[model samples]
Each structure stands twice: as structure tokens, then as C-alpha cells.
Target: MKPNKHSIDFGKEEQYLNSDKFVDQIICGDCYQVLKEMPDNFIDLVITSPPYFQQREYGGGGLGNEDNIDDYINNLATIFQQCVRVIKKTGTIVFNLGDKYLDGNLLLVPYRFAVEVQKRNPVKLINELTWIKINPTPKQNPKKLIPSTEPFFIFSKTDNYYFNKDAFLEYHDKCLNNGRKKVGNEIGKKYFELIDRSILSDEEKALARKELNETIVDVHQGKIESFRMKIRGLHALPYGGQAGGRLSQIKNKGFTIIKIYGNSMRKDIIESNVETIKGNIHPAVYPEFIVQELLKLLTKEDDIVLDPFLGSGTTAAVAQRLRRKYLGIEIHPEFVEHAKNRIRQNINNHTLDIFI
Candidate 1:
């Protein structure tokens, strides 16, 4: 499967999808009906941002057109229950749902959906990712500030879900991490002085000096990028945020060390603006880079990625670019056509060697 574009005449297909032909094809069909037809343990990674409840006119009046919030939740949750059945034991689902504001108050649509799906299925909530929109839609209500965040809930049916933490770390490193830090000429000299001047027994000073010297050797030998030592009496106590391991180590051992590997920043929040592709007719589309990051974190080459609510084929495009198999189910024929054209253009824009 060396970067070939799949073509499916969705209108001519009078029968349900054959599971073997799901790879690299974007089909026009209702999600629940289509998913029910597929067998169990099919997809490797499931990712989609379904139509928001009453956010806009999707023209396909199934999931988003429910009268009340409960109806909407039930519809979405039932579909998710089907999704859970289709994914493998090690598969993961990443669902991004937007919040709706009505009658001067907010409806916790995403959170409520999270609760509903977990209650109905044999799934575990792995993580809640908060996507911060750099440019959000403006609100004319003078009484309230603008809403700029949405949630992407990640779920897994079992504990064997595939998570490439090194790839996840590399994703953040590309965005927020710099290369190895350069040390000054007097790297550990100040720590030696602080250790000697501290109110500690001679034994404590000797141990501190030994550890500091070893750390300096590690830095120079390129084992680590950089480090900072906090003396018990001189420097403020180190805070390891909520984990508090660093602070406990300082209290017990009379010193603490901060090590920077320059690999990752521990963060659940990501910043991406809403995207609108040129040929895309869908009202809402998530950013491509966000999908790429998640794909890198959760999948390997040739793994199947499914997006049930394929608006503009963002998932398909990113999957193809990354050399992964993708199957998208779009209900609207017009949106399906748009997704096809957009994905074709996306394929032509770059070769397999480089992804912009």
C-alpha cells in the first residue's frame, strides 16, 4: 500500500460494506447502520469529532438533531457503544465534542457524553485532553467572555491499548522542547560552595559533592542535557508539582536534583485553531496537525484508523500521509464528495517523503 488513493462509488453500493474492503476507502453511509454491519475487533484506532448538538445545520439529521440533551447523549452514546464493540481489545477511541451555550448557560455536552458512554460500555477513560482554540468564535453576549476550549476524551476497552509514549513525547518536543542546553564554564562550582556552607554534617557535604560531581560528569558525557541541584539549607525546596517525589527526596536525603532530558513537557492541553479547508463544505473541521499528533501517538504504519463522522476527510488525509490505512464513513453525499476532492488534493500536495 504505497500511497495509493482508494475510490468508491458510494451511491452504487446497495449492500452493506464488506469488512475486507474497508482499508483506504471513504464511504457514504450512516454510521450506526454501517458499523453494525461490520464484525467485531475491526478497527485499530477510532477518532472523530461528531456533529455538535444544534451547533449548526449538518443536513444529515441523525445524531445532532435530537430535541433534548438526553436524546442527543443517548444517540451519541449508543453509537459509541457500537464503536466499542467494533474496536479491538487494544484499540483506543478519541472523541472530540464541543460545548454548546444556550439560555445564558453552558450545557456540559462533552462531559455528559463521557459519563454516558462509560456507564454503558466496558470502557475506561484513559485521558481527557483539553484543546485550546487559539481563535474561537466570537460571542455577542456582553455578559460573558468567549469560550475557547473543547474536550477530547480518550477511552479504551481494556488495559492493553497501544500507547507510544516516546512518540507522544516527541510530538511535544517538536512543538515546545529545545535541543540540549549548553552548560557554562562554572557548571557545578556554585553547588560545591552551597553544599560546603550549608548547616550539614561533614558526611552530608561529602555525599552532596559526590553526587554533584557525578551529575556534572553525566552532563559532559552527554547522558543528560542539564541539571539543577537544590541544597536543603540554601535553595528553596523542590516541588515536583502534584507527584512531590522531588520534595520528598530533598527532605529525606538533605538535597534535591532537577534533571532535564529535553524530551517532553508534561501537558494535557494543546493549542490549535479551527480549520476550514478551501474545498470543504462542512461547517466545522478539526485541525489536521492535531489528528497527526494523535495518530503518531496511537498507531503504527498500516494500522487501520476509522472516523465515523468524516466531515472533510481530515483523518483520511492524515492517515494516508503517515502511511496508515483509513476508512471514513460520511452520511451526506455532498460532504462525501467534498471529502473525496479534498483528500485527492491532499495526496497530490506532498510526496511520501515529506509531510508539511
Candidate 2:
């Protein structure tokens, strides 16, 4: 008999802390059952790329092998609904779903799932990002355009959520491209006084003014730009105040002012040349960089990150490296073992080898 959802004990605060040791570990079982056992508003972030419908066959009742596309989407939505119960109101969910082609037609599985999920739950559809696969497996169709991109749908349990803009600022050096030229203009304005009437001498002020004008000209003229704006009077901007303005914008002159880099981060496009996972039975293993970006953006240190479709444990491994607690649920025992061993290897940095 199945255990009652409410009856599942959360114990006292001390006991809960002891049991919270379940964090950073993979529980091999059905996702629905395991998620039902978890406490409400327990997870801070949920990032996972569940198996695509009818994409692959991993023995022992793997996902993505549903009878129909609608069936598969509905099933996935049901699991995510359970995830919503455990996810905090301020939490976020980033699901990376790929599309499939049937009878020479494209099926928008990712968007379909997004709509279905929102319809069934009270979550908000926050953002829609695209993951362009630079090196995707060659398709048999030369007549049709080669498949190269996937949809990354971001959802929030509530309108207000926690987002760390600085987490994905790895390429900060070349962030201020033409996309953020308006930011450059704003920076020029903010520092106008420093160049106009600062505590510096006449000669020093003249030199500062020249430098500021040159930088602004460079920005307006579509010259190379970076996030490190050398100006005075710093003010915050949306999506990371370092830039002093918003992201990409198009001017009336038909030119796109693109901020190639931000003090906080880059654009929605995550460039990935898929790398093969060695000795992994699962057909699809999420790239570590992808998981890292999502975790950093949606979670904080020691926050609970849950992955219901824990195929090969990419999310778990990345979460461990990021120092955030992780909870993974996988139905297949073999895949579960794969995830556990992978996590162990990543954490120890020592291979499990025998010296006989």
C-alpha cells in the first residue's frame, strides 16, 4: 500500500536536520513517490532535461517512450506538478526539452509541455531560452534543415523569485558590445560631472573629459566594448547594474545596440558543442556547463536543487560541484547507480580503481 502524503513524517526541527542528510544524494525510486515524500516548499531550484518522448530506449521503463506525444507531455507535466508542491514559492524551474520529428513534420514538444504545465499548475512562464547546439548529431535529412536547437523553458512558482545575475558572468571581459550602447551613453552621462567639475585640477579634468568622450564615441561608433566601464558615479542597472542599463536594444536608426558582455553575464544563448560522456548507458547526458548556469542563476549556496528525471546524474554532479544540496530521483536502478558513481567520482576526484 502506498503511504499517505500527509502522513509522511517530517519529524521535529532537529530530526528534520538529521534527515536533511538526504541532501546531496540520489534516491533510486519512482519520481512521483519520492517527490510526494518530500516536504512542501522544500526545493529552491529544479533543473533537469527529462527524456524526450520516444527518443531513446533505456531498459526498465525509461521515460520518453510514451505511446503518444500528448501522453508523454501530460505525464511529464504530472511529475512537474508534484515538483511544484515541494518547490518554494520563490523557487524556479528550468527545463531543457528537445523536439522530435515524426513523418517529416516537426513536433514542438518543449513548448507543448510548457503550455500544458502552465495550464495544469499555477506557475508562471517566466522566460523562454534557446540552446543552440553547435555540433548536433547529423540527421538523415539533407532536404530539410539540420536540427540544431532546443528550447529551455524557465518557470517560477510565484511572480517574485530569487535570481543571481552574477553567477553566469564568466565571460565578463567582452560583455559591453553594441547591444548595450545605451548603457555606454548612460555611463557617459553619469560621469559627465566628473569630467565637467570634479576635485581635480584643470589639466587633470581636461584629460578625464577627453578620455570619457573617446570611450563614449567608441561605444556609439560600434567599437569593441567590455563590461569594465572606466567611469565615475556608478549606478545600478537592471539585469546587473554594472552595465548601467538593460541588455540588448535596437535604436531608431535600424542598428542593434548589443551588449556583448555584462558585469553580470551574457545573453540567453548558451553555446554548447556536445561532449560525449564515457561509459554512460544513457543516450543523453546534460552538459555540466548547462546545469552550472541554471544552478547558479536560480539557487544560492547550500540551497536544495532537485532533479526528478535524474538521467545519468548531470544535475546532481554539477550541483555538488557548486556546493548546493541536491536530490535526484531515478526510476532505473542501473541509471541510479551510474548517477551515484558519477557524483562520487566528481566529489573525490579519485577514480574507483583497484590495485591488485
Candidate 3:
């Protein structure tokens, strides 16, 4: 469909709107107006953190001018209506949002937006993950309590949407092993018992148990004849931590023990750290980790990804890095320049692997 020319004013900003320098370029214009021009089912994934209603100044305008909560929901739904039309049937939309506080009442903007998106679009509510900010700024409310964290709503257009369970699993693994330590005497007793209870002949048992006994001896051989060293080494080796050092001292030793008696487990998602363009063009710039994770999960190398509210071009940058095609729309000129510079820099730095 042709774009609604009435809503867009691509006068002097047309220079940055289209570019051949970056394989995935940034467009400078209103997102609602620009999205209408894109072809249908052209994008693979849509991940963005839209401006919160009436929260902060994004230079384009203020987000908190919705008049009321209902108006905010309606406006968000209108944007998603267009987003749903352009997104592929198998595409996934992950929206990072937070609640808004007004008149001392905390409005659940995240939940409200999720409900509105599901109501207006064909997306399915998949997960409501909490992004617990480790070092969140304390809320400055004298009368009430402090709020610290936010929510990320993960939605999909179909049941067969892309999800990298392995990446999430790796995150879970790190969290699980944060304060893990082995139970020294208890573990030793269990290990010895298992060795003694073997039904094999003496020679067979000796050979089979030799490896286990050697492993235990190696732990206590050079170190102080304590179980701490053994347990520390075991934990470190599995977690890819430092192998041998005085830093391996088991202070306040904790153990993340995993008992595996049945079948082997496999994770579905894979995760990696991705770098971002150096500049604060958008306030709520999503981490490249998120974009890379989404790309790995949702689409193939050649698939297309779309971001209607392409703040600082994180989605496009990640798409380029992962060798995927991307289309981004931004409503602000400053952000458009920021995104364009970011894309160009990534291309020059060999961060983006453009396919065509």
C-alpha cells in the first residue's frame, strides 16, 4: 500500500531517509507514517522499547500526554495495528516496557500495553519476563516505597515463533552457579559408597574406580588436605572459570549441585554479547545482547527483521551483525542521524555482515 503522505513530511530530512552506505539504512521520519509504506510480511522480528507514556522527553515529544490511561492504550494499539500488518506470521515481538507513576498511583503501563497489543494484533502472549535491574536507581517517593525494576513482554504472532531456549539456559546456568560449593565430607562419603557398592569383580572394580579415585586424589594432592580445594576445582572447571590459582580459595563456599540420574538435557537458545554504537541517541536503548538473542532464535541468517520504533538502530545493527536483512523506521531527525551513523560505523568496523 502507498504511504499516507499526509502524515509524513519528508522535506529536508529526505537525505538521511534513504542511504546506500549502510546495507541496512535508517529512515528519518514518523514511524507511523513510514511503516505504512513498507511491504507486508517483510520483517522477521520486531523488538523495541517504545517511549513510555508521559515519562521522559525523547526530543520528538513527550510520551505522558495521553490525557488518561485509556488514551495511552489506544495510541499504543494503533501503532501495533500497523506493526502486525508488516510482521510475518511467524515473527516475534518483544516489547521492553515499564510502569508509569502519576498522582502517587502506579499505573501498570506494561500490562496495559500487553493487553492492548494482543487485542489489536494477531500476536500471542508468550512470556512476561522481569528485567531486574541489578543497580536500579531508587525511586524518590517520600510517601511511598521505591520502585527498582521493569518488565519485558515477549509476544509472538504464531505458536511456532522463534525462541532460543539455550541462550536463556546459559543465563540460568550462571545464576545457578553464582554461589555454588561442593559438600566436602558428605560428597566424599557418597562417592566412596558408590565405589564400594559396585557389583563388578575386584579387578574390574579397581579399574573402574581408579579413575574416580584419581580424580579425588588430584584435588587434595597439591592443595591443603581439605575438601574445599577439590570442590572449588570441580566447580571452576565446569563453569569455565580460572583453573588454578590462589584466588580459588573457597571463602564462604557455596555449591550449585546438579543431580543427573536420568536423561541428558539440552538448551534450545544460544546467547552472546553484542556491542552497540557509542552514543546516547535513544533513552531506552536496548542492549545488543537482546537483539542478538532474538535474531538467533526467531529467524534464519537471510530472514528479515523490522523495528517500527527504531530508536538508535539496535535492531538493524544486530540484524547486520547476524547477516540478516532489516528495515527500521524512526520518527526523529536526531535519532535518524544517530542510527545512520551507527549503521555506517558498524559497516566500516566490519561488525555487520551484509548479505546483499
| 10 residues in a row with least lDDT, candidate 2 | 247-256
lDDT of 3 by residue, 283-349 (tens): 6676676566556656788787777778888788888887888778777778878887777877889
The order of the candidates by TM-score, greatest first, is 1, 2, 3
Q: lDDT scores for all predictions?
A: 0.80, 0.70, 0.61
What is every candidate's alpha-carbon RMSD to the true fold?
Answer: 6.5, 10.4, 11.2
Model 1 steric clash pairs: none
Each model's TM-score? 0.86, 0.71, 0.65
Candidate 1 residue lDDT tens string, 98-141: 98877877999999999989888999999888888998988787
For residue 345, model 2's alpha carbon misses the true position, in angstroms, by 1.2
Residue-wise C-alpha lDDT for candidate 2, range 1-356, written one tens digit per residue: 12232221223122122254557878776676666667889789988888887788766564577667766776688788888898899999889998888997888888899999999999998777677787888978779888888877889999889987656634333353423545434755656664454444566556656665676676565453432322222322235554333222111111112333223334776767665777887878877766777777788889989998898998888888777889898878889999999888876884221111
- For candidate 2, the per-residue lDDT at 221 reads 56
Q: How should the candidates be ordered by lDDT, best one leading?
A: 1, 2, 3
Runs of candidate 1 exceeding 4 Å displacement: 1-14, 169-181, 214-228, 235-248, 260-263, 351-356
Name model 3 segments beyond 4 Å from true.
1-23, 62-64, 168-278, 352-356
Candidate 1 matches the true fold with a TM-score of 0.86
